[model samples]
Target: MSRPTFKRILLKLSGEVLMGQGQYGIDPETCDRVASEVKAIVDSGVELCMVVGGGNIFRGLAGAAQGFDRASADYMGMLATVMNALAMQNALEKAGVDTRVQSAIPMASVCEPYIRRRAQRHMEKGRVVLFAAGTGLPFFTTDTTAALRAAEMGCDALFKGTSVDGVYDADPKKVPTARRYDELSYDRVLADNLKVMDASAVALCRDSDIPIVVFSIRDEGNLAAVVGGEGTATIVRKPQA
Candidate 1:
């Protein structure tokens, strides 16, 4: 299959990815490696935006299960994302990549608040924009934020970089025979209960007519290869008529 050229893309990274070999928290070396991968894409002329999750630090659902109020737990998760964003910003800057961190929750002292036009300007000026804090509200995942931001920023696609290389019919780790899909449709994903992303995020991307590229960030240099359509991944979008 041919890969569609994406001039602009929003890369969604899970917080777990930053954990590296540890059980929790961000690893500086991991952040640096990811930053270098991002820099490669930016240097290759792709306008980049990013959204990183906070599961490694604080998970809203887990906190709620342990007795914390759902909203408050989610707020904590949002703060965790801010920390991750700052770490990423530092790494990107050290790599000589112009980067900005925009928070949905508006902590003016730490980073700039989310402004569509301002973000667009940053990308136009060849700077990478890191969107943090998950829509500044409770009950939303960074997945949804990535989708929403991708649409709002007029990004051509949403690149979901996870541990697995692509979407599969079942848990590949548990089910050794699980089938990996080269492509998928939004409706099929929802109908089949595929865990490529959360339902709301999938629906939003579907509604916005934006494709979601699921690929592995664990493989060094894979992001650049996937963006160039030479690496393994699953492209989820509307089925061709």
Candidate 2:
């Protein structure tokens, strides 16, 4: 595959990645490592923004499954994302990277509200923006938020950092012989339910013509390598004839 040169990118990280080896919550060491990877990309002059899921702290659907009010649960989940964003902001700042936290839900006291122009300005000033609160609405995953923000920010690509290195035909952890795709069409992924991301997120990226790069965040330094198109990852975009 040819290497892609991207000037700006949005990184979507699962909240579980912040858990490190633990069962729940943010792990300081993991945050620091992730922050360091981010710093490398920034040093390379790639404008970056991030959207983090709240699965490790709270999951709206999981809460609903446990009998909590759906909307209320989703709101709580959004708040969890804010917490994760704050943790990431702290780590990034400690790494000597300028960072800002923007929440869709508008907690003025904790962070700035989601403002596209302001975020763009922050990036122009070389500050990473962490978008939290998952679109500030129920029934939408942080994946969708990433796609939306990536398009709005006019990013070159959306980098999805996951536990797995790339999208596979089957669960790689369970299916020893599962095939990992070097590249895939967004339609194929959605049609086959490949699970590269939520359906909405996939559709949004497809519509916007934004390539989604799926790579493992657990491997230290992988983030920088993948962004540089020198590491293992699956690129999901429109398939050529």
Clash numbers, per candidate = 0, 0
Query: Cα deviation of 45 in candidate 1 (Å)?
Result: 0.6
| Candidate 1 residue-wise lDDT, 13-93, digit = tens | 999999998999999999999999999999999999999999999999999999999999999999999999999999999
lDDT of 2 by residue, 24-96 (tens): 9999999999999999999999999999999999999999999999999999999999999999999999999
Give the candidate number with the greatest lDDT. Answer: 2
Model 2 worst lDDT run, 10 consecutive residues: 1-10
TM-scores of the candidates are: 0.99, 0.98
